[model samples]
Target: MARPRRIVLLRHGESVGNVDDTVYEREPDHALALTAKGRSQAEDAGRALRAVFDGERISAYVSPYRRTHQTFQSLGLDPAKVRVREEPRLREQDWGNWQDRDDVRRQKAYRDAYGHFFYRFAQGESGADVYDRVGAFLESLWRSFEDPHHPPNVLIVTHGLTMRLFCMRWFHWTVAEFESLSNPDNAEWRTLLLGPDGRYSLDRPFDRWCEPESYGVTG
Candidate 1:
């Protein structure tokens, strides 16, 4: 195949941080484990994906985080039919280091006030930073397409922010559009289906935290 027929972007399931941000103080963000409900959610998403795929071969790229790895494993795709790689570029936006829950909350408020796209964490990356890397990763993805035997279906197991940024870059969305869309639910995945003309289209629109038309006007 040249370009994949479908690109599946998935957010990792609920992790310790999802239920309790305080875990960051003691546990590294990359090491956070998924909760029981998260496992169930991933399993359910897996079943749904398998049904859509009907046992087709997949080329999978997963984030390096523990939770993402766990999510990919829970997807239950047949290993013999899937070629998977641990993609560091798909990792969650760096938060600098271990965090204090209260401080993180305060920073998040600041981020929202300042604007989500450009707002940088105290010692971490802004949304645009993640976009750059995801764009770079796309180059690699396209390069793989040069091989005639490349799988027709692509799967990405990653964090919410990265997943969103991947789409923004791929679809050439503006900063305002990026800010308007909310993150996907844990274990949720979006399908980007290839059109007859070779362009990709998302199966559904994302829920917005803010109105899309509000951006890019000056007084």
Candidate 2:
């Protein structure tokens, strides 16, 4: 096969940040840990992933963020059969330093007014910036495909936004297409299965989200 037999992108389990915006006021986003339920979610997700792998070895690229690292550990995959690497490119979209909740909310409104792809977060990155790094990460991934020792299955444990950008880069989706897609649920994963033709197809395409304010409907 020209590429791995499968490429699975797994969003990290729910973190403290998911339930409490105040966590960002105290802890760095990169350092947040998963919630108790999130640990359970990762365990279930791991079982589901094993079913998908069906005895094949796993080659995993995990984001360096604490939550993702914890998620990867919780998966319970055989450490002996899985090769793991910490990939910073797989980290969450940075909102920058300790967050002020109200300010973050205001920025999101501005982001909505602009476009998802182009809206640069203050002291952080625009989606385009993330896209560039994800693209670079893909180049390295392709290079890894050339090695005979590369495992047959690949898993990426990362953030939801990073996962979407990954599919955008790999599938060559347009900005509109990207914008229309919703993120995978926390601890949920989307798979890319390799067919006989050496191409990849999503096990299920991402769900679509409506732009409620679009189409100029006046209230």
Best by TM-score, which number?
Answer: 1
Assess the local accuracy of residue 209 in candidate 1 as a C-alpha lDDT between 0 and 100: 81
lDDT for model 1 comes to 0.91
Candidate 2 lDDT over 43-154, as tens digits, reads 9999988888887888899999999999999999988889999999888898989899999999989998898889998999999999999999999999999888789999
Which pairs clash (backbone N, Cα, C closer than 3 Å) in model 1?
A: none
Give lDDT tens digits, candidate 1, residues 45-78: 9999998878888999999999999999998999
Which residue pairs in model 2 clash with each other? none
Off by over 4 Å in 2: 211-219
**Whole-model lDDT values for every prediction:** 0.91, 0.90
Best model per lDDT? 1
Task: Name the Cα RMSD for model 2.
Answer: 4.0
